[model samples]
Target: MWLSPALLLLCLSGSLSLTGPSSVTGTLGGSLSVQCQYEEEYQSYKKYWCRGQNEGTCDNIVETQGEAKEKNGRVSIRDHADRLTFIVTMENLTADDAGSYWCRVRKTWYLGFWSSGTSVQVKVSVSPEKAMMFLSSSSSVHLLLLVFLKLPLFLTLVGAVLWVNRPLKGPGGSQPDKEKPSRSAPSPGKPCPGIQPFRPDRRDLQTLDSRAGGQQSLDSGGT
Candidate 1:
């Protein structure tokens, strides 16, 4: 009798609830291992590691009976009856090897008929060379962004410094020349050619006379 997909899943979930990591990740050409545990009653069953396919079928990789260790090309399986657990190890992993895997058990029951025991899903992830390339590209982009962010501030500071130390202008908005003073200019004792000396007006004379009269009265009072 062939078991339906739903029936198989129900039997697997009800008979044995396998416990292990949901996913495993590894680098290119690296190795990884996973462990699955079952109840003590299923200790005598054959434990197997299989890769999942899209057509609802599992491709068998390695299997063991009772308590034994078996190794294939790059896959290995170990069944421990004493601890009621099985371990699957894969080495020299590549990107193509990344996919869904299953930890399955098989047993004989009901007079020479084989029964599917239980299975648990395990997802494997492998990082190829492209992942490293992506990281390198991301770092370069971040560096460019950092420079772009700081460039304006740097330019602004440079402009401010240049402006602060810029050459000063004279009163007519032009830079003053650095020529020496001309010898033909008049000295302090001689007057400028276009200027004239001052002469007192009538109001200045009247103020001077009043100040002299006050001095004379003070002198008389002292005498």
Candidate 2:
């Protein structure tokens, strides 16, 4: 059985234990650094940072040629042979910088060349101001929704209070008015009616009794 170069690289990568974060989060306009540690056997190999694409392939971004430190534009790499580790730094991050990357070691045997190591997914988040604005807008929307949800209940409670305090009505379906005492006319130059109001009549008593009986009979008939 013979193994192809790509398959051999995959098998080697699975066997090698590289230490680093599986995913990294960064903020826009900020910078981030990651450390990848390899085995002692790969200390003499060239260390590389690459942007991973489909099918286990990557585009090389930067490499350290056994140098202590190297930089390219916004990317910097530091090789530490004593520690068996390499540090990669990316500055002035943006949304477009978010993607999958690999910290790899290049190895060339007698017949083929390949890279093997671990990968990290980098995610660049939105700016702080934009995040805060989104949160503020969401809070305002929730507040308005709460007010709208409670408005009908508030109106119903007010209506119930008004209904409870409404004025009492008479049998004719109209609010009754306070009654004023009646006054009689004065005799010609004799005395005011307020002073000569003591008069008892049998006919008036009879008329009241007849009106009371008539009211009772009408009420019973209606019931």
In the range 40-157, model 2's lDDT, one tens digit per residue, is 8778888888886542577888999785788888888999999999999998887788888877776676566653444443333434554677789999998887788777788889
Model 1 TM-score is: 0.51
Q: For each candidate, what TM-score against the reference?
A: 0.51, 0.48
Report the C-alpha lDDT of model 1 over 151-215, residue by residue, as the tens digit: 87888899999999999999989998889676687888788888897789999999999999999
Clashing pairs in 1: none
Report every candidate's CA lDDT: 0.83, 0.76
Point to the candidate with the largest TM-score.
1
Clashes of 2: 0
* Candidate 1 all-Cα RMSD: 9.9
lDDT, candidate 1, equals 0.83
Clashing pairs in 2: none
